[model samples]
Target: MQRMIEFPTAFWVSQYTIRFAFQEEISAENSRNVRLFRTFLQQALSADLLEVVASYATVTAYVKRKVALQPLREQWYAQQASIEVSVSHTPIQIPLCYDEEFALDMQRVMDYTGLAYEQIKQLHLAKVYRVYVIGFLPGFPYLGELAEALFVPRLAKPRQRVAASSVGIGGAQTGIYPLDSPGGWNIIGKTPLKLFQMQRAQPFLLDVGDCIQFYEITKAEFRQMEVNSY
Candidate 1:
């Protein structure tokens, strides 16, 4: 059965701001609950609501200055009790090149995981990753709860700068560096895909609660795609 929590009593602190918090224990086996929670929160959006943010396991909804806290809070509680969200099964596929030229720390990854290059590729490509959050950098997505066997620690010392498009793994999480910046995560591969393009109407390519899948591509293909401006 699905689990849920609710905040029925609203605590008013000021004319504009009120506080309400709920902690619901959800199934962590997959990203379904995360996605459902995000969808449910989005349904709450209206003129009175200002923002809605979802993290790994929690969603926060903010309201506008004119909205009355107590009535809105009560409505929110009722909505939460009745709302049902369908989890999405479709995954967004991303193409990446893991050749030595593009892979910054391939050897280190192989050594640490005690797995062959092919094995590393298999593990990475096999699973569908859920975007837990988008932070640290604009459009930088923190993805996974990688298969336990593939979990690896962050680098002992962070690099002064890592290249943009760098794909890295740290702990149970994996991410792509949207921009060249200082970071401690272990680099595994690089994607030619432009994760964050400022020129695009939507600057961020990925958002919280979305699913991502990475596919291995060749260096030549990567170059060709880049040339074509894909």
Candidate 2:
């Protein structure tokens, strides 16, 4: 069965790069539409396609040769109403430790939201977030639509080194740092899971359109899981 897809405004980014623009803002519907379209293009242009990338609201395809706009547009219009793309909706449970040691910016978050630490933690755990787009770092999952009360701005100054698996909230979104890299998202917790384990058959624990839920864990539990991760 084919999915009901909305045709995006297609444009040429370059001679060999074509982009499909969906909605201008980030939302679950837009993400789904973008992913579906990317999947469609991969199959439709298999011979000419080099690579396809999906963001919040756009799909960019790198091709082997220049694809004329008229023919591509005709194909896009013809295929718009029938495109099949499989997407997983099962929520992955991420165990998080929100103890003072790992939550470096918890105080800042508390001050900004005027919510107690317990309230903040509960708010974060209450919602199932969607992986809107993965970027900024390899295997990083930009989960979105965070609980309204838990929303807080990113740090004014990004940290020089944010530990891998550190979970943080920024405005209406939340995400986990997959590697030790500089970041500005307000750090609220840390996860024991290695989000970007290159040694594994599947390098990434999350992907675009995937769902996630966070569960609270004690420091001792976190250490146990951390030791087992290796």
* Model 1 lDDT tens row, 1-230: 64554432345545544444334432343244445544554565466566666666555556665555456546554665455445545689899888888778878888888999898888989988888878898888988868777788898999999998899999888999999899989888888877888898887778787788999889899898777654
User: Which whole-number lDDT from 0 to 100 does residue 181 have in model 2?
Assistant: 98
Residues forming the 10-long window of minimal summed lDDT in candidate 2: 80-89
For model 2, the stretches where C-alpha displacement exceeds 4 angstroms are 1-3, 68-85
Return the lDDT, model 1, position 19.
40
Q: What is the lDDT of residue 139 in candidate 2?
A: 90
The digit string of per-residue lDDT tens for model 2 on 1-230 reads: 55545568888898899888987998888887787777778778899999988888889999999876667667876876666325557899999999999999999999999999999999899988888888999998888898888878888888999999999899899999999999999999999999999899998888777889999999999999999984
Residue-level lDDT for 2 in candidate 1: 49
**Per-candidate TM-score against the hidden true structure:** 0.81, 0.90
Model 1 spans > 4 angstroms off? 1-31, 66-87
